[model samples]
Target: MPTHLIIHGRVQGVFYRDWTVSTARRLGVSGWVRNLPDGTVEAHLEGSPDAVEAMIGKMRDGPPAARVERIERSEAKAQGAEGFKRR
Candidate 1:
């Protein structure tokens, strides 16, 4: 599945995006993660259903520093991305 995620609460400045990149890559997921101006983090995750779900699970407790309040997920078209990144 290709999924868009908006992560909220104490996400920025806590290395959430870098943690996401590492986690996504480790899970063999492909997509991009970026910090939003609204003090949230956004990401696109594309991979097997299991991998995507796993990635999302990890994102829930990001980097030991992030206090993830919630996450918003939605379906998205595949980006055909080769790897995960921090945008």
Candidate 2:
């Protein structure tokens, strides 16, 4: 299944995107993560149900330097994402 997430908090400039790429790749999840102008991090995660859920849990905590406030998630159609990337 695929999931889209809008993560809010001290996500940008905290290595959040880099961490996400590492974590997602490690979990074998394929998608992209980017920093929104509104200071939130947006991501499209596509993988196994368990992997996606695990990624969500990790996003809630973010990187050690990040203070994740909340994460908004929704179902999305897979886009045949090949690998995790930071955008």
Candidate 3:
């Protein structure tokens, strides 16, 4: 299964996307992350259930500079992405 997440709060310009890519790749999760115009970060994570859940937890904390206020997640079909990316 895949998980889609919307991370809100001081996430932009705080290396959130870069951190997400590094964390997801380190966890061997395949997905894409991007910044939304609404100042939120969005991501699609796909991997083993454990890895996906781990990534979600990481998203909540984000980088040291990120002040993660909240995170929203939902299930989605896996897209077979080969690696984590920032879009």
RMSD of 2: 0.6
Model 2, range 1-87, lDDT digits (tens) per residue?
899999998999899999999999999999999999999999999999999998899889988999999999889988999999999
What are the runs in model 3 whose C-alpha is more than 4 Å off? none
Please give the lDDT score at residue 77 for candidate 2: 88
TM-score of each: 0.98, 0.97, 0.97
Task: Rank candidates, lDDT, best first.
Answer: 2, 1, 3
Q: What is the lDDT of residue 21 in candidate 2?
A: 99
Indicate which candidate wins on lDDT.
2
Question: Per-residue error at 6 for model 3, in Å?
Answer: 0.3
> Tens-digit lDDT track for model 1 on 1-87?
899999999999888888899889999999999988999999999999999999999999999888999999999999899998899
